[model samples]
Every structure is written in structure tokens, then in C-alpha cells.
Target: MHCSTPKTSASLDPALLRANFPIFGNHPDLIYFDNASTSQKPFVVLDEVCRYHTEQCANAGRAAYSWSTQLDRAIEDTRARVAKFIGANAEDLAFTSGATESLNMVALAWGLLNLQDGDEIMLCQRDHKSAVLPWYNLKDILATQGKTIHIKTFAIHEVGDYDLKSIKDQVSPRTRLLAMTHIHHVFGLDMEVAEIREIVGDRVLISLDASQSVGHIKVDVAALNVDFLSFSGHKMFATTGTGGLWVNPRVKDSLRPMKLGGKSEATPEAGGLNLKHKNTAELLEAGTQNIAGILSLGKAVDLIDSIGLDAIESHVSDLTVYLYGKLLNLPGIIFAPGMGICRCEAGFGIMSFRFEQISNLDLSFVLDEENIFVRSGDHCTYARDTSEEYIRVSMHLYNTKDEIDQLIAVLEGVVG
Candidate 1:
């Protein structure tokens, strides 16, 4: 592997990690390249989920009973665990349905609370619909208050390079928030948000969707200096509908809750109104908690930590380089780092492309017939449509060189 980093991190054995996932045992020949959608959970995370339902099943933070106490403790501990995992305080994180819900909460709560007339939010075409939709859906609501939200995009060349000038030009003093993704869903474009932060200064609140890169890489919320960030637990090997949002400590008071009910992650008073609502995670998460999923998500973080982030990053980066090298030589493969429009090498979770001879769906079918799985089409960038439909081959810690080789063999005959 001619990667910029080391070829492999032998400290964490990829084969051993692969064995921990049950799907490999069930289908030995299966090559799961759609990890960006949802990752295959390790037995550790599954066991934690089952254990929660079997042993300590109870509603959290409601009753003084032992079961409720146990469940509540588990939920809070997991919250702290997830918080530390992302380099933030426990209070900064809030459990939600997923990144989508988390982002929506920010848009509906923070945007509604702070935005005024002539304020704007910046986004880009590369953003997944979930990233854009949350803010995009707010135009009408703001209009009622005589507010007009001017949405803008960061100018990106077809080659996927950032136009720094456009970033400086677009982010005016009236910009309220800059909403974008840490990694583009379609083609694995890992954006350097630190630079974007520098350009925007403190003019706008930076809300990042780190759904694609959080568990796979080392993401320090403090270091990124973002006001708000959201990520998916399912994509990080946790349960579906399990994720959290990180709200900057300073902004928690300004950001309101999207879902509210009679649940005591807080204390109630004799007046039937809140005596005190702590500005921690409790402020954002309301209603009955997903204790089982939250516990399992904690276990998922444990599984990733066991391998070590540096090792995991090294392994995937190497495999991506290897896959790029093999696939680039093939004719008609477009938009991968070394092929088509993008000239840089593929370095993250996905390698997306459109083939010349075969449609993406047809290619997906052929791979499916071979027991090789992949994802095709626009991949939920619903607003951003190009002339070509792209297929994404996303990788995880469990993926190996052998599986990549098998994929190359399948594509060689079809495209040649």
C-alpha cells in the first residue's frame, strides 16, 4: 500500500476485529462495503443491548425503585462515556434519535431562538440532505417573524478542492450559522473545518455533522472549535436511532429542547413548572429515554477504543489507498481520488464513482449476486443531483485486503 501513512497497524489485528462481528461468521464470503450507511456491530455491543433488556429493563430517572435507578445510572454513565470519547464534558452531549434528529433540534431550537431578519446560514452542495434539510426547512418559520434566512454554499470546484476565497466572501457579518458535514456522504470528501473556522472567525456559529468520521477517526470537539456537532451511533457500530449532539457550553442556555414531556431527567416543583432545568444533556433530551440503545452505544465506543483510534485510522487509510491503486487502473471509473475529477487519493470511509459501461444499480445488482454488498445512487444528497449516479464502497475496521481484491476482480471483467 502506497499510502501516506503506514500500511498497517499490527497492534490491532484486522482479522480479529472481523471475527468479533457476527455477519462474517454467518456469511464468510460477504464483503460489506456499505459501512457508511450502518456498520456491522461487534458481539460486545450486541451483548450489551441484550443484557439491558434482559436484566435491567426499566424507565430511567422516573422512579426511586432499584431497576429505574440502575437503568438511569447506565444511561448517565454512557452519556459521560460518549462525552469523553468526543473530547467534551458530559453536560455538552445530548442523546437523540440520531444525527438527523440532533441537527433538527439545533435548527428548530437554536435557529428559532437567535436568528433575526436578514440573518443567514451557510451550507454547500456536498452536504447530505439531513445536514441541509434541517436548516432548509426553517425558511418559512423564520419568515413569520419577519426574518429572511439567506442560505449560501461554499464554492467547490468539480475537482473537490475548496475555494478559500469563496469561503471568505460568503461568510458575511450577518451569517448566523455555518452548517456542513465533516465528511461528504457521496464521495468521501473529508473537509478541513479548522480552516473554515478561521475564515468565519466568531461571526457565525459552526455546526458540524460528524456522522461519517467520529468513531473512525479521532474527533476532539474542543479542538475543532465548533458550537454544535452531531453524529450517528449506528454508523459508528452502535444501534440505529442512537446518537447524540454536542452543544457548546456557552450556547446551551440559548438552545431550547425540541422534544418535551413529563420526564425527570430534571426536578419538578410544586407549581407544576420547572424549578430548575440543568443546562447539561438533560435540557435537550426529553421523554422516555432509549436506555438499551444508549447502553449499547457505550459498548460500541468501548469496542472502537479497544482497537485504538490511531490503529483503526492506519488500517482503513491503508486499505483505501490499496483499493484506489487497484481501481484507478481500470477504464471508465470516475471521481475516485486517482480517477475522474478528483486528483487526490481516497483516504476515508468511502470511494464513490460512476462507471462508463454499466449503470450504478446494475453494478450493485451484479455485486449483490456475488454476495458482495455496496450502496448506489444519490445516497440521500436529495437536493444535489449530478449527471452521473455514483456508487459508494465504504470500509470499516473489519474490512481487509482480501475483500478489496475480490471487488477488483469482479469489476475488471465487467468494465473491461
Candidate 2:
């Protein structure tokens, strides 16, 4: 299917879009605001996933039977569709379990092979732990091999954006790679990666964790020019256990497969064994793929394409501003530092805040009682302090101002 260009509009109708999701019908009182965790699946995606499992169930790239071949072709088609969704080539994208595995693949498969003893890796304390911990794990593994790798820390500005000055000060000649988030999970602000690319120059490879940005905004890898980009499918309206890693053609050869089994070729030699692997995106895919989830991802991309990312972005941004304005009116409300004020012009549909007198956990329990779903905790960032937790309200196109109004009314009653 031909992907349609995203259309920009003044607004979208939330009540109409909400009809496409069955979850809303199943639970009439549910007001889902935790989009950063996982988006509710549209009927198109759910039906496609079910259809593939029941009617066209077969293993891809394994056999020449009609069902198997059909599945294989469908998988490749989905691969191209998903790659196009991010403005990347089909050969450059590889499927993984999720963003966590994708990040780990880069650390183990690429970092293990390319990083040297004196090389330094840059990371942000405010980014998700999945993006930060993999590199540290690489450091530990390299330590056992008698190699020293340094982890340089960067900062996030008071406004929740990347601290460009901090990055400039910390970047060095030995900095081999910089791992960062495209959009902050907790602060819900775009990290401005293009500026980061300018600071690091062309030498340092960049690995971006785009778990929060891809489906929510217009993400073009060609424009960002990052060496590696990773994201989870579930966060973007696809099924769980589905995600992708896009490698820049310049760095694709640098990655060595971490998992090896079926489909990987090896030959015996006099000295030992010689491993032969394709340098394309398939290099990282060693075992049988997630056939059902991947097919659903294609449908999700199609749905997004039909709705247009511009429309989704506009709708969600407006909802975020509305939510922020209402939250600000509530007395004793304290937004997460650096995210205290809503940047109407910038930022995705996410915000974190807490009440001065009410504990985050208590507030979450009260909100749950009201059937208002929200996330409250450290939000999986390395920099979070468990003692100072905040509640996260992440919006999507299906959400409405009426829901936000309800949330505000509940808070008003509690705080009153």
C-alpha cells in the first residue's frame, strides 16, 4: 500500500477517533492518559494481528511452502513499510523484541566490536535506564577483557532539553559514541538531536533511543543523521515484543551479530570456524522473527499514515497545553523540575507533576479510584529519586479535553 503524506490541520475530533479503539468500549469509564507506556491498539492493527495468526500463520524465511512464502513476502513488505515510516531504507532497519533489546544490540554487537580501550561513551543521566545501562554493561564486559572504557555523563537543561553546553564541555577526542533519547520520557520535551550532532561533529557515532518520539512526532532519521536509532513498537501503537533498530549505512558493517542460531551461516576451517553473516539489517536478526507483531506494525503504520502525523502531533500538543493550564490552576501542584511550564510550541503529549501536600502514590491511588489511568513513579530514568516521585500524564490523539477536564475536577476535589 502506498503511504500517504501526513496532513497538517487545526485540530482532530477525539470522540470520533476514540471509536476505533475497542478498549474504550469495553471499559466505558476508562480515561487512558498513559500513552508513553503503551498506546491503545486500533481495530485495524488488532484485526490484522488476529487475521495473520488465524488464517495466514506460517514461519517466515524458513520454507518454500505457499503459506511460508506468503508470510515471508508479507514480512518484507512490512519491513519496507516500517522503514519508510521513519524515512529510512528497508535494508537499514532490523526488527527486535523492543527498544531495550535494540539498545543492547548496539552496545554488544556494535560497541563490543568497534570501541577501543581508550574510547569514551557519552550518556545522559536523565535518559531512560534502557539507553544508559547497556553501555555500562559494555564497560563491565570490556573490563574483564583488560580494556578500559570511560562513560562520560551529560546533563539536561533546566527546561528539560539537552544541555548543549554540558555536552560541548564533556565531548572529547576520545568520545567514540553518544547515546541519548530523542524525546525525554519524564519531561516530555524534544531533546533537539540536530544540535547535539553539531556539537559532537562527524566523528562520534550517535545512538538515539526514540521510544517516545517515533509514533508521536515526525521522525526522519535522514534529517537527524544519527548513526543508530532504536524504538519500541508497542509505544507506537503496535503489539508488545515488537521494535526496530535502524543502522546508518555508514555504520552497518561495524555491527556483529550477538545472537546466532538458525538462518546464520558458518563454515568449518582448518584453524577453527568461519562465520558468514549478511551486512544488511538482517545481521542482527538471528532467530525466527515475531511474525504476528510485525504484521500488526505494518497496519499501525498504515493507520498513522492515513491519519497523518501532523494532525496527531497538533491534536496531542493542544491537549497537553490544555492539561498543563488546568494543572497549573490547581493549588499546591508542582510540576517536575525543568517541566514546570508547558512549552506550547515545542514538546510532545506528556507531562509529569505532583501535588505539594499529596504524595504521588496517594494521588495515583485516588485517581485510579476515579478510573483515570496515569503513571506515577521514577519513570525508568537513571536520574530519578524514588523519594520524589511524580505522576505522568501522557496524551495521544484519541484523548480529549473533556477527559482532561474530568482529571482536573477530581484533583480540585482532592486538593480542596
Best candidate (score: lDDT): 2
Q: TM-scores for all candidates?
A: 0.93, 0.95
Model 2 steric clash total: 0
RMSD of each candidate relative to the true structure? 2.8, 3.5
Tens-digit per-residue lDDT, 207-292, candidate 1: 99999888988889989999999999999899888998999987888876676777634445686545256764777877887777
For residue 123, model 2's alpha carbon misses the true position, in angstroms, by: 0.3
For model 2, state the Cα shift of residue 316 in Å. Answer: 0.5
lDDT score for candidate 1 against the true structure = 0.81
Model 2 agreement with the true structure over 42-119: per-residue lDDT tens digits:
999899889988898878878988998888889899999999999999988999999999999999989998889999
Q: lDDT scores for all predictions?
A: 0.81, 0.86
| Model 1 residue pairs with clashes | none
Candidate 2, clashing residue pairs? none
Worst 10-residue lDDT window, candidate 2 = 1-10
